[model samples]
Target: MNNSVFRRLLLPGVIVLAGCSGSTDPETAHLFDNVKNLNNGEYDRQIASKDAEAAAIVRQNNAASARISTLRNQSASNSAEIKALTSQISSLRAQTSSLRGKFSNQPDKLAQLNQLDGQLVQIRADVGAGTSPSVARAELNRVSAAIRALSR
Candidate 1:
């Protein structure tokens, strides 16, 4: 009879210990799964943010390159215009010199011619030194007006 009782007690104790083993409860397992999902979602968001930032940077770089190209084109056009204007000014200077020679005997006209020549020389220097197109053009107009007056 004692052996029978001992056997009965040992069997129930073994069953209770087996139930208490390291197996996770359903609630605990669900919590762990939820934590893992949260971490993955956060990681995915970070990756998306980085991708968006990279795209923005690419766009900005492209825009900057386009602006630089436009500026280069404008500079080329301005340079060409400056060259043409310089040639026109040289022609005007030659004409002025010819007129000055014709008026050499008249002191008053000679003085006026000298003043116009000086102005032309200054304008040519400014243009050659890369002054703005508008400024150079305006100076050329003034010189042209002076030459017309001298002719009259």
Candidate 2:
């Protein structure tokens, strides 16, 4: 009976002591570092993917910004052209009015002045109707030539 009890107790104590032995082997310690490095590698890949996506978004935003700047520049240019055209039209109308008074006494001169006035009115209407700046400028130049000829 004493031998049986001693055997049972000793067997259980040996098992407990063996399990408690410290794991000091180099291979066992390096296993933990290997697992940590693998997890770090996966984290690095995820970071790279996110950075690439963010860079693509930034590129798209830059393109959009450039397009917006181009549109604004075009709008400003159009506005300036319209303003200049309006000024030219006003000046031409004044010249026509002045010529009309000067030529009222002569029938031939009056008819030429009337024709020049008609051309001015037509060009004004074309400009108001959104004619391109080049076309409107060409027509204004033609009218100005006529007015100069009539004055002579």
Candidate 3:
């Protein structure tokens, strides 16, 4: 009788302990997967690649922005330089024309003007944007000035 009673007590305790012990299987209420069961290495690598790509994109954008700012500064300086050089070139040409009334070599003055024009074109191109808008405007103005100089 005592053995029967002890068995009855032990059976309920064992059942209660089993119920209290948490099961390894995840509950249905949870949404994301458990980190431990990440079996597929490919999926992990893909996720990391996506994250790295996103970070690289942001870094690229930041680098582009910095480049744009540098271009803008160069553009502004070039614009000023173009204005000064244009004024100087005009003066030099006028003086050369006066001198040509006495001398014979017209090719020399023309060659000098052409060389300066090339420099001006290059400056304009550099001022133009790889990514920046502010620099593009500066570059365009200088380019227009250079074009006008050439047309003359």
TM-score, one value per model: 0.69, 0.65, 0.34
Residue range 92-125, candidate 2, lDDT tens digits: 8899899888888989988887887888788878
What do the candidate models score in CA lDDT, each in turn? Answer: 0.80, 0.81, 0.57
Q: Is candidate 1 or candidate 2 better by lDDT?
A: 2
Instruction: Please give the distance, in angstroms, between residue 20's alpha carbon in candidate 1 and its true position after superposition.
Output: 25
Task: Summarize candidate 3's per-residue lDDT along 30-96 as a digit string, tens digits.
Answer: 2223333244354477578889999999999999999999999998987776566555545544543
Give lDDT for model 1: 0.80
Models sorted by lDDT, best on top: 2, 1, 3
Report the C-alpha lDDT of model 1 over 25-66, residue by residue, as the tens digit: 324434444455455675467567889999999999999999
Count clashing residue pairs per candidate.
Answer: 0, 0, 0
lDDT of 3 at 145: 65
Give me candidate 3's TM-score against the actual structure.
0.34
Q: Which residue segments of model 3 deviate by more than 4 Å?
A: 1-51, 94-152
Model 2 TM-score is: 0.65
